[model samples]
Target: MDANHLINTLFPQGAEIDFDGEFFTGTGQVGDKIVAVLGTQGGVYIGVELAHRMAGIVLDTVRNHPGRPILLLVDTKGQRPSRRDELLGINGYMAHLAKCLDLARRQGHRTIGLVWSQAVSGGFLASSLLADECYALPDAEVRVMNLPAMSRVTKIPLERLEALSLDNPVFAPGVENYRRMGAIRDFWQGDLAACLATALDSPTGPDRRRAHGLEREGRLMAYKVAERVRHDPV
Candidate 1:
């Protein structure tokens, strides 16, 4: 099915999915197996909500049934770039999401994030960052920033960025760069089921890239974040 069809199938318009305005949104079983759909348009509030709901689901599932894998599908431009979102304590909300993901890890729930389209900036951090494994579609236009936007924001000329993007996969926009960064595990090139199965089959542990040498690459901050998590379990 096409992307729109896929989204409609997953999150039907009439479905009574629970949502707390900007903080959380989802529809799934009460325990064990859970599937969440997060959009990119929402801001930090959405991230906060996503975390709150996931924690609730995890807690409920753990108290009742054996922990099951959580499937997450992400298609977002990024977190809300709004003054109100920042003023409403975005950092605290982000921290809450981090804590919820930590709970999932500590409890041994396989957290998998799938990027079907755009996964960027704070939106990526709020959800995708916490995954034990992450996968992106080959057609996904993923990136930290689009060239023109990056140029405008950084005050760098567009031609210079174009030059850099050609030589530096780090500056380009695509799924391949993230793979080189080790931030992504598998690229959904053909068979979606097989790719999902492989990601599900991955052994649980700290990402090696998160541990050593690769730190000096594009994901320097991610590396440092991983180290901090290692030093303190929480």
Candidate 2:
């Protein structure tokens, strides 16, 4: 969904969100709780500058308003392919951004991620997947490297991986498949404001996603492996 439609759905009373043609940043109320809103559009490839800006946004919100919810709207194609960025340690900048969001979580600010469009590669990893509670719209496209790229990297036949991905939710590319893999916890619908409000109130810290994935038969071995690790102490 476009930002305007999304804003209308979520903030009927008009959220104080400012949208440039490129990206959006602002704060608004979800139910009775005020939240920090950060989003991107047009499938922009996020670079180091954008990543650091996102970090700043979270850091400012956490410093000024502790315990407030932070909402992330992830719509990025991937990381910007720049040789200079690699030289300048873009990886470190992304890590810093992740640290900022983690700091928000540590400070008791609930973080939520909503994906209605592209959620791919380093862009998604630096933000959306880091949320305390993650969800996706039905139309959201969520995936890592596409099958062809995976084949190229692993030197496996694309046809083989494609067939496997059809049966294995973890290998597939869809919102429901991510939910199945326990990455995205739920699907979102109904009243947007009320839904966000409920999400804020019901912060599932240390949730049962790994177990849910196994129960749903999507990520079969993850929970068992974790349990095994837990039981067999060093």
Candidate 3:
């Protein structure tokens, strides 16, 4: 969906959003509530500067907006893969951005992520995946890595990965696959304003993605394994 159309749909009361082609940050009204909005656009590659800038917005929202809910609009390719970024510690910057969002959640600001377009790899991880509840638009694309790339990284062979993806949503790349894995809480469709309102009014709770994964049968053992680890007498 076009960014402007999405903003208008979600914030029918109008918003004060600003988009500079790649990055956008602003505030929008959802009913009687105001939400802090921050996100990337056009499948931009997230680098040190972009990560730092996003983190600053989250931190500022926490400090200035008190308990206002935050909305993350994710659409990125991944971290910028370059020697300079590596030398500058791109991982640290991404982690900082994730931590800033975590801080906002802890500080009583409801954090919601909407995957309106593409969300891949570390870019998805540090943004949408960190939200209290992450939802995807009907046509959103979400993937950690493509099969050929995963094959190269894991040496699992493209054929084997392809066969695995048939039954295991974990090996697949799509909004449905992600929804099955519980990475995406749900899909937002129909009246978008209503969807946003409903999401905002939803109760906050502990992360349930693992449990959802089990129920959906996409990751049968993840929740059980996590439970075992949590109860381990180490």
Candidate 4:
């Protein structure tokens, strides 16, 4: 989907915004406050430039908005897959963006991440994955990579990975699978504006994601392991 069309659907009263193929930052009258929505689209690869732009937006909002919630829309391929980016310390840039979002949450501004499109790899991690509340569109793709890539990475055959994904959703590649694994909060079955408003109005919850996954039987061991570590740290 074109980013402009997606933005229009999200912010019908949007009058000020900007998108330059890396990230989108703008003010839209979605709810009561002047909600600032920032996101990536068109398989954006998060490099140093893109990372700094996104981080700057979050930091600026936190400093200026005072009590407004910031909406995160992520649709990316991943961090730029280039030797130059790796050489320039892309990991540090990613961490910087994550820190800026974390600062927003700390400053009493509600943070909501909606995977309106694909939320892949480091692009998701450094942005929406850090949201106080995160969700996904029903048609959105939310995963690290597809089964074939997982197969290659793990040295397993694609057929074996495909078979495993059928039963073990942690290895699957859809919003449903990600929700079951406690990665995404829920599927946005409503219109984009309504969904954004609802999430913005909601309070941030404890990190019960692993618990949600365990109860749903999608992920069986993550919660227990984390609990044990909390009780007896190594």
In candidate 2, where is summed lDDT lowest over 10 consecutive residues? 200-209
Two-way lDDT contest, 1 vs 4, winner: 4
Residue-by-residue lDDT tens digits, candidate 1, 41-74: 2323244455455456655544554456665665
TM-score of decoy 4: 0.93
Highest lDDT scorer: 3
Model 3 scores a C-alpha lDDT of: 0.91
For candidate 3, the clash count comes to 0
TM-score each candidate.
0.71, 0.93, 0.95, 0.93
Q: Higher-TM-score candidate among 1 and 3?
A: 3
**Which clashing pairs does model 3 show?**
none
Report the CA-based lDDT of candidate 1 relative to the real structure.
0.62
In angstroms, the error of model 2 at 58 is 0.4
**What clash pairs does model 1 have?**
23-49, 24-49, 40-76, 43-80
State the lDDT of candidate 2 residue by residue for 1-234, as single tens digits.
787788778877668888876588898866566788999998888898889888999999998999888999868988888998898899999899899999999899899999878899899989988889788887888988788888999999999998888777877678888888788878888777777777788846686778888877788998999999989978
Ranking 2 against 3 by lDDT, winner: 3
RMSD for all candidates, in order, please.
6.1, 1.7, 1.5, 1.8
Better of 1 and 4 by TM-score: 4
Spell out the clash pairs found in candidate 4.
none
User: Residues 1-234, candidate 4, lDDT per residue (tens digit)?
Assistant: 667777777777663778765567887897567887887778777888889888998888988788678888878878899999999999999999999988888888888888877888898899888988789888888788888888889899999888887877877788888888887888877577787777777767667789888988889999999899889856
Flag regions of model 2 displaced more than 4 Å.
none
